[model samples]
Target: MKTDQEIMQNIRTAIDDCTKGIDDAPSLQYQIARKAKGEEPVVKKISTTIVLVAALLAITAVAFAATNGIGITAFLSRIIGGWNVNENAIVAPVVKENTSKWLNLTGTEAYWAEDGLSVVLKVDSADDEHVVCYSNEDGLLDETGERGEQIAINGEMAPLDQWRGEKELIIAEFSPLGEGWNWYKRTDDGLFVIVTFSTPDAEALQKGTDVAFQIQDTNIQTGETEECSVTLALPAMTMQEGHK
Candidate 1:
């Protein structure tokens, strides 16, 4: 388990050792000119090429391990301080079973604010056609603006240009303002989404804080509402980020 710096250093050392005293350089420009002239351009031996490729692969693997590993791990890291969710969030991997037997929802990360809580949920459905989704303006409209004819919000059909903001929309079972918005994307294994809302009580949050919450979603096909409950407590920023 080498640190990034150590791994880089090891790669550098290997490259140097492999290319030791093998200065076949006529300069890159000159080598290219030689090749252009139909001459055998100066090149490293196959062993050296193999070493370089291996080193490159190792570097790539390290980079991926450092910050791009697995779906859930990267999901938590990516939204740690964005989307109204911040570092003060307590990120716990929660596999909460939804009411629907065909689908499963997991809370990968979340944060509690005075207003309420925001949770990142990953949905895995056995039947692709029976996937879970929270109907909103964005999801209703596709690239060709097809759903434009019939707009929907909060899993219910609404008139075109019918306005609904966070204040008017209350989504979660326990949230003061459910912050109902359709925000989700597809993943290889399942669907990734973020659920945010206002809490009934505005409680001051400090480090090592724990809070419980419930997130709900509806099926587009069957109009079935499913909920997953979870509690998260982790190191949190006491104050809103970028403020005193």
Candidate 2:
């Protein structure tokens, strides 16, 4: 059996490997703008997005280590301490709800700290089997089969490209944060995804900002693609205290 330290070391290594070439990660602004303008964007695998969160988590760990000097174990505890076995347990105090005919966004929990913002989304769909895909200017790329999707923020079509010049707001990371089976499992009833957005300006994000979260899915038999989105009105920022 692996010791706790050993496991953490392994995680660190995985994070390093996953984030090694983040410069190559798809450009968020360019792709989204291309699609908005009716152009086809480059193809990127879904794993790229998933690995992104891993990289962000790794970055979060590093930031915590720099401040607390405790270590990764303690950092992990501090970040996920609110997680409950039931999954539905209310973790963050600021929660919201949005639903559509095809997609049911059951719950959204968000928190903001000195470093950045963390969001957890609980989604349910009516389709028996849905293919989650990423949209580029060219068209939809199946996450399970083709691999990549355009990134969005606060329902606005703006891409990271536009903000590259702005030094104040930096999108350190944005991707689905999942673990074990939750990472790969796709079900009709309940699907949970964790998304983390890091920036130097946590204050701006925490002060009741409006941001859009978007996801695209395709029906297998019908060959119809649907775009679903939720606009979240985030409340004021709060420091991450002890586990909720």
Candidate 3:
């Protein structure tokens, strides 16, 4: 009869030999003939266990190869065919038609506009937040003077007298500062675009950085003195085949 220590040593040796592909007994053949006659056969049991483990490993390797693309052999070919595009195309210059009367309000030196609300050309110190354009829905400033009531910004409504500054106010009820003054409009392009400008201020300039962030490009542009320009990508519609 093998002692407990001897059985343990045999088990350890069997594990090591299995990993090294070595076999001290007939490969995976469990000779249980003696065991069926009431005799213990430990070696046969160890052999069966190693064979079962080896079979499992073989099956796992086959499954892994099938799931993960064996290697990068089809990498380039797959990407090219998977992604195809219509490369034939043309590039045309975008033209705009200007209709707003305020485009060149300061002077002819302003930036040229192809579309009244598509873009704005301005002299130096341009205010990118005051230009008026069409609004699809009710906006901060509406087309009718009647809807200017109840407008607010950052939760605060503009004071009546100071709404459009004293100069822009024509009537007490129409003042931008009025309780419901709407000084903004929503554009057909699905956005709100306003343009406002201010003269050089020592206090506003002394802050070093810009206090008024809405002034798109306040710096000077080439070929002109005191020139500034701002282009707004508004939500607009296009004709699709049948729709005009």
**Prediction-by-prediction clash tally:** 4, 13, 25
1-244: candidate 2 lDDT, tens digit per residue: 9999999999999999989897787777877889788797566657875676667666766775687554343234334423212222224433343433455454345555433455655544444333221233212234343422332432333333242222211111113322211111122222345555545245555465655555555543345555555556665655553423
lDDT of 1: 0.48
lDDT sort, best first: 1, 2, 3
**Per-residue error (Å), model 1, residue 95:** 4.7
Model 3 lDDT tens row, 161-198: 34333222211111111121122322222212223222
Candidate 3: give its CA RMSD in angstroms: 33.8
lDDT value for model 3: 0.28
For model 2, the local distance difference test gives 0.44
Q: Best candidate per TM-score, number?
A: 1
lDDT of all predictions: 0.48, 0.44, 0.28
Flag the better candidate by TM-score, 1 or 2. Answer: 1
